[model samples]
Target: MAEADPMKGVVARLDELVAIRPRAGGGFAPGGKVRTHQLGGHRSGFRGRGMEFDEVRAYQPGDDIRTIDWRVTARTGRAHTKLFQEERERPVLVLADARAAMRFGTRGCFKSVLAAQAAAILSWVGIAGGDRVGGVVIGPAGVATFRPERSRRRILSFVKSIADATADAPRAGEPPLAAAIAHIRALARPGSLIFLVSDFFDLDDHAVREVERLALQSHVTNLFVFDPLEAALPGAGSFPVTDGRIVARLDVDRPAARAVYAQRFQARRDAVERMSRERGMTFLPLDTGQNPVDILHPERLGAKPSAAARSAR
Candidate 1:
């Protein structure tokens, strides 16, 4: 038999990373305690096409007669009725950042690799949950968009496309994160769920504001993927630094360099968290060491009560 492809192995491990719950008393858990709520199996929130009762309003021109609530008309004795229409399925767009900086990682794997795994796992969850999944892959080469589609096959294809895009890309200048956010705003419609995955190292305040603008129209999930080394530098002595085209030696122990590095990393993390909270977006900080499958699974994340557990309840 032919040996299994490593990519397939990586993808098959999706279940392991799905729904990884933050440890009890961990900083990531709410109130520093992991809630025991079960989640998974059955869908959460709105599902399928059906008119939901919004609110009764005065009759307006071009309003569908079928949507008019007769009981309201009888009670009020005025032209007022309930409006309803087919509810749109939530479209999930994964905005992946494949900039050059993400190409580096001192532990476990490259940030780019982790990003691909995260994107694949999330796509699987979205597809399995009966939602459409699509994404825009941005790199130095350019941007490519995969239209929202609901199918296991399509999701797999999307993952493969991402893998291909990052395989041979040169590591150089940073890509335009703000411009990509603008593209997402233009392409995605209202009520869409956008997963913005990036290390977010090169973004400016203006770029952050632009991202907030995109979040206004959709549910945004800011997934910050980072390597442990990014948070704390290793004790390695002075090392040579290269800008791809130029090389120079710098002391890692320099007080200014150490201070600047720590400050920059912390500031970026703080900004990302602040933006997420301000806009009501889900902030998922994933370390490269964590399993992607666990992160994608809702049950493991304590999102909702599982079906069996709910029945027991």
Candidate 2:
């Protein structure tokens, strides 16, 4: 029998990721100790096609007859149209980084694989919460975008796009993060939530500016994924590592080198945190060694019951 393709196991899996949907009940679960309650679904803080009635206004020439406020019209003896603030369907777009730099992993999976998994989980959560789900995958070749929509077909299409785009690693000459942000900035309108999942290795000034622009119009969330080793190397002598380009041995036994390595990763993470805080975006630092589900839904783990579960109790 031929040996199995390691990429298949390591890169991305739609089925398993989608299975985590039921875990996504409510709120914006992040790295912080406390919970975050974000409005979506019925609580979505947007005005659009919804069932809830906002007010009644004088009937305009183009007003739909189906939306006539009969009670108000009969009482006031004037034509009025029911203005309903449709509980807006929140749109969530996942940006996955699958460039060459993401191919390396020391533990559970490569950075790119973790990215795909994180995207899938986000997609499923959005779908579960009655939100429009879509994504953009930034691979070596280029980028693939799927329009956000609330339908089984669209959700499946987004998942398939993510899987296909990240199936094989590609080499991107320029910094893919900036381009990905540009795509998101163009697509994002008000009432949209954008999730950017990456190791954030070499984020430049251009990307930070774009993120700020995006935050101005919509909610921006950063899911920074990194290998544990990248954060801190154990004092276990030389460690082999690669970023798909350079294969080198890192001297973990050297305290000075380890401190510098840890500081480098910490600085990148701090940058993301600072940016997110200043602009009111949610930032979650994901460890490759940790479970994605746990990062997304920490309330479900161990002895703690979910908020809903706690309420029922």
Candidate 3:
């Protein structure tokens, strides 16, 4: 008999990551006001295509004479001009974190695995929507970057890098969260859609500033990946914990200890969520116990995993 793979959920596989491409269709496309001039499906904040009618208002000096609404102008005995919304393609960049801290998980899969799968889905969705796909994978081995390109080959290479990064062992001199974010910002062009997928164990003020810089020109979405155990200690008990080298026991039975543990995690999560909202970035929690596909595409995959479940300490 063959033995089961011990690192099943801890390490991601290229095949599994590639398989998520098909499921990336439908409700996976992000809706937003992009800042690009390229023609595409998503609507841009500026008007250009004039395909969809916005409204007819009083004609201004700079208004296009061809857009003058004759009917409305005749009715009110005044000139009126029509406005329309322009649609354009947005570049999608997934900043996937496969850091050492993301290697641990209590349910579903490791944070690294969840981040990788979600990254793959986002990349594919961007390709399907006619947007260029690119990203940066932050792992123990360091940062790997990919330039935005509207090609399946580029997405495959990106997914493969994610899988490789997740399976790599901890190496010295890995880039910090702030540095990684800065790199991602540099890679992303103005008006690109960026996905920051990580457990976010190192989102300090410096990292926050870097993200804010990125958000100034791009639409940023922070995907907070966490495990059930990280959110709260298990019910009253002494749980055994280890990191493959060091072993310890958690006394969750103690009320004070449990309270402190839960409070610390909640505080961190809250701070991240609050910062994202304040900066007008989308914040979505990705629990390891749930499917990334379902969370990313709730309308197609059904109701998302409950937040209440994670709250029950």
Candidate 4:
């Protein structure tokens, strides 16, 4: 028998994703060292006085010197330390867009496939960390959502839904990724880790505002799934493309046509980046050609601890 091609099947297979586990747990280190992309450490729940500086108490045997309250120590004639604790257990929610734009890819898989693959990797990671897994798949057909759950059955169901939603092409009479982000706004809970996977072809002000609002309470990471061909033309040549309605010939050899075409994608990417930066959200660039698992794992990120927060983000 022959081994299966990673890209030939369901963006990503459940068995394949589950097979790749993190060396360490998906949580952060003992102290707090998160990557630049994350807000650092979980704060969903707390044990001691966190950041409010509630009060100072006599230093215990294992008290951290950095937290020593100088004024309180001197006045009390005894070393005292400030105390703060933060505890958290967050859910991972993946929002995938299978819109018409994501339906086209000039690589091993479609942008929708890439989106599903990325979502599956994150879902398995969340399961590894003991977090609930859930997702929303929005495509030409409409929006499909799954509530976060820690059960394997729930995670598998969500992945299947994503693949099914993206399996078909855009119909001529479909609406524009209807109520995609709006659905997320309604489903995502505070302190949850939200992954938005999409080509963002129709990101209007309304969509932007919904994401912005969701990020205010939940951690939102924008996973822009695009194809390299969308970023640049294949040298100087003529290519044929379609949006399910009209099949058009693109003559990249024409003057400035390639530049204009590439700029359109660049501009949208730029806007998403600017928004992400301003909000301290994580932005991961994934193309249909790359292996989504290697690029998205919590430990494999450019920085390990930093990558740790990507799942949390």
lDDT of 1 by residue, 1-313 (tens): 9985544322223333343212332111111112234232222222112456546677754455676778888888988756433345567788777667777665556677778777766665566555677888777676778888977677667776667655645756545888777776666755566778888876787678777776544556677888876786656487775534687875677666777787878888888877777655666787777666555443453333223222211
User: In candidate 3, what are the lDDT values of residues 143-238, reduced to their tens digit?
Assistant: 898989988888899999999999899877878888889888888765577889987888899998898787655667788888988888888988
lDDT of 4 by residue, 147-239 (tens): 889898878788777777776656765444336777777877656777888887777887787877766556677877788988988778877
Best by lDDT: 3
- What is the per-residue lDDT of model 2 for residues 1-313, given as tens digits with 9 covering 90 to 100? 9997655536676665566454535433221122334454443332223578666777865456887889989999999877655444457778988787777677788777778787887777766655677767787778777878879787887777676666665654744688888887777756577889888776889889888877654566688888887788788687676654688987667788888988998899889877877766666777677677664664433323223223211
Q: Can you tell me which runs of candidate 2 are displaced by over 4 Å?
A: 1-5, 18-41, 45-87, 172-175, 241-248, 298-313
Cα lDDT listed for each candidate? 0.62, 0.68, 0.76, 0.67
Q: What's the CA error at residue 21 for candidate 4, in Å?
A: 7.5
Please give the TM-score that candidate 3 achieves against the real structure: 0.78
**RMSD in angstroms between candidate 4 and the native structure over all alpha carbons:** 8.9
Where is model 4 poorest over a 10-residue stretch in terms of lDDT? 28-37
lDDT of 4: 0.67
Name the candidate, 2 or 3, with the larger lDDT value: 3
Model 4: residues with Cα > 4 Å off, grouped in runs: 1-42, 45-86, 172-178, 240-248, 297-313
- lDDT of residue 190 for candidate 1: 55
- Residue 279, model 3: Cα distance from true site in angstroms: 1.1
lDDT: worst 10-residue window of model 2: 304-313
List all candidate RMSDs to the true structure: 9.5, 9.8, 8.5, 8.9
